[model samples]
Target: MKLKTTYLGKVYSFSNLKELFAKANEEKSGDRLAGIAAETVQERIAAKEVLSTLTLEDIRNNPIIPPEEDEVSRMIENSINERIYSSIKNWSIAELREYILSDNTKSEDLKRISRGLTSEMIAAVAKIMSNIDLVYAANKIEVITTCNITIGQKGTLSSRLQPNHPTDDVEGILMSIKEGLSYGVGDAVIGINPVDDSVENVKRLLHATHDFIREWKIPTQNCVLAHVTTQMKAIRQGAPADLIFQSIAGTEKANRSFGITAELLFEANELVRKEGTGTGPHRLYFETGQGSELSAEAHYNVDQMTLEARNYGFARCYDPFIVNTVVGFIGPEYLYNNKQIIRAGLEDHFMGKMHLLPMGVDICYTNHAKADQNDIEDLSVLLTAAGVNFVIAAPMGDDCMLNYQTLSYHDVATLRQTLQKQTAPEFNRWLLEMDIITEDGILTNKAGDLTIFNR
Candidate 1:
C-alpha cells in the first residue's frame, strides 16, 4: 500500500505500517521517547492522510508484530471471523470511521463489524479520529457484561470502590468500603490494590470484601489486584473471589514482564469459571494502560495507542467482566501532561469499547504528571458522557497504597447526580434499600454518612 503523502507542497513518507501508526498518533511522550513520533505537525497530518487510505486488508497483512513472532499477535489474528473479515477487508480506515459515526450505523451493526477487526485496524481508525470524534462514535456502542451485577447498560455509570490502604489492614480496608458504600459507590466492584501481594494477604483482602458484601447482601463483585499467580493460589485455597484480577499488556514480551502468558490467562479463566463465586459467564477483570509496553522495553517501536488496542484484543479472548485503562498512572514520561492524558484516556476507552469489551477508565494521575484532581475530574466527566462503563473511586481521589490521585467517592456521587446517571440496576436497588439514594437515584440525607452502615 502507498505510504507517501504531500502536505503543503512537502512530501512525507512512512517506511512501514509501524512507522505510519506512530507518526499518525497525536503527541505522546511515550512515542517521542521511543524515537518514532512525527518530526513536525505537517508530517503528522501527512501520516494520518496516508493511514486513512490504507485498507483493512493492508493493515491486517502488515502486522505490527507478526503472529509467528508473538502469541498476542497470534491470538488477535486467530480471533477474527474470516467471513466477517472478508466482507469489509477492502474498506479504508476513513470509510470505517465514517461508518461508525454514521446516523444509520447502530450499536449492533458496530458489534457485528468488530468481530471482523484486528487490533491494528482498530488502532488505525482511532489515530485518524479527532477527540470528539472518538467520543461521539464510542457513545453509540454499549457493552454490557456481568459478574455478580450487570454493568454498561445505557443511562448507567458505575464506580469501582478502590479501598486501598497503605498497609493492607483489614479493618482499614473495611472502613473505606463502608464509607464508599455510604456514598453509593462500588456498584461495579469492590476492588483493592493491596500493598502486600502475597497469597495470604490477597486471600485475606478477598475474604474481607467478600464477607462484607455477603453481610450487607450487596450486589457487587470483590477482587484483590495482585499477581494472577498469587490470586490463583488464593482461589485454590478457597478464597471467596467473585472475579479474578490481573494487569495485562499489548505485547507478549510486556506480558511476560508482568509474569503472565496467554496460556496462564486461559488457565486462570478456567479456574475462576469452575471455582469462583461469580454468576454465569464473564468473570475476569483486566487493567491496561498506554506506555506499558515501552515501560517494559517491549514496544517494538509501535505507538502506545496501538499497543493499548492490542491489550483489548488479547483481553477479549477471555470475555472479561470488566477492563479499564489506568490512563494517567504511568507518569509524565509517557503521557506528559493533562492534554496527553486526556487524549489517551478517550482513545483507550473508545478502543476498548470498540472491541466490545466492557470498558472502564481509571481517570488518574501521578504526582509528577502535569495533571491534578481537576484534570481527572474533567476526564471523568468526558468519559461518563461517552457512556463509560465505570470509573475507579478512591477515598477523596488519593490512593495511599498506589500513591496516585484518581476520582473520589464524593466525585462519583456528584457525577451521577450532575449527569443523571444511575449505578447498575441491582446496585441501584441496594442503594435505595440502604436509604443512601432515592428511588430517582438521587442521594438521600443518609448518604455520605459512614455511620449509616453501623446502624
Candidate 2:
C-alpha cells in the first residue's frame, strides 16, 4: 500500500500523504511537502489522480518533466500579422459568408472575413464567387500553389516523411529508415511532429534531422512541426524553421487555440520567408482536417466538409506551399466512420484544388474509428487520381505519437512509381542520382537500400 512521491528529482515514499507530511513535519518542512502534494493533485486531477498508483521503482524509471515554458515569446507576439483580426472575429459565419457574396464588401473586409470562417462557409464563399474572382483573389494575395523546392515539376506529387516521436527520440527516427524506408531521406520535406513544445527538444530534433540529411545527402528539407507561434520562437532562437507549420481552421478562435490568429499565421509565414527558411514561395506547410469546426464548436450548424473547404479559403490567404487535409485523423466523432472519412478526404482535396491551393491528402484512419488500412488505401487511390500535391509517408500509415495510422512509406513509393508520378523536382534528381529510380520512373535495386542513413 506504499506510494511514491517525486519532487524536483528526489523521491519520497509513504502509505499516504499524511505519513509523508509527518516525516516532513519532523524536519519543520511540512509546508514544502504539503505544497508539492497539492500542486501534483491539482495538475493531474482531471486525468483522475485518485486511482493512480506509482511505486518507487516506477518513479525511478520515469523522469519528471519540467514545467512548460511560455509557448509564444514576446518577439513572436509582436510579429503576428498586423492585419486587425477583430474585423472578422466579431462576425457570425452567416454574416461573413454574406459579406463575401456582396460585391460591396471591401477587399479588406473579405480578407478579414476569410480569417474567421470555417469549411462550410469557406466552401460557401468559393461556391458563390465566380471563377474569375477566385483567380483574382489568388493573384491579389500572391498565392503559390505549385513549387519545386527539391525536384519535380508542376503536377508532380510529393510525399512528406512524418516520423513523429514523444521526445524526438533518435532511434525511433532511424527505425523508420531501417525498415528499408528513408524517412527524412525521401522525396519531399522531412517534417517531424514534436510531441511537446519544449524549445530545446524541438531544436534537438531539428539538429539531429539535419545531421541525418547531411549524412545521407538527401535532397530534402527538415521541419519540426510545432505551432506557428512556437516555430516562430524557435526560428528566432535559431531552430531550423525550414517549413512554417500550422493547423488552420475556418474560425479565428479555433486557430487561436493552436496559438495563432489569421494575421499571426500570415506573420509567421512572412517571418520564415524573410528568414530564408524555404525557397520558391513554398515556405508554409499546413495540415487541415474535416470536423475541425465542430471540434472547435465553431461549425455554427454548417456541415463539416463545407467548413473544411472554407478552411482552404482561409488557408489560401497565406498562399501556402503545401496544404494537407488529415482526413479521419480526427477520429469517428466528426467524420463518423470509413465512408465519411473517404468522402471527406476527396472533398477536401477537390476543395483545395478548387481554391487553387497545392493540396495533399493523408488518407488515414485511427484506432478509435470503424475504419482500417483498406479505407486509407481506397482514399489513397482516389487522392492519387485526384492529383493530390502531396501525401504523408509514415510506417504502416501509422505514427507512434500521432497514434494514428496514415499512409506508409511503401504506399508512397509504390503509388508514385505505379502512377508514373514524379517527386519534387530536386528530389527526382536525387532519386535519379542514387539510381533508385530509372529515367522512366522504375524502382531499382538501389531503392531497396534507401533505408541506409548513409550510402
Q: Which pairs clash (backbone N, Cα, C closer than 3 Å) in model 1?
A: none
* Candidate 2: regions farther than 4 A off: 1-155, 175-185, 448-452
| Candidate 2 per-residue lDDT over residues 124-193, each given as its tens digit | 3333333334433322221134333643244466888787765667888766654424321355577888
Model 2 quality (TM-score) = 0.67
List lDDT for all candidates, in order. Answer: 0.93, 0.59
Cα deviation of 246, candidate 2, in Å: 0.7
| Sliding window of 10 residues with minimal summed lDDT for model 2 | 24-33
Cand. 2 Cα-lDDT: 0.59
What lDDT is obtained when candidate 1 is compared to the true structure? 0.93
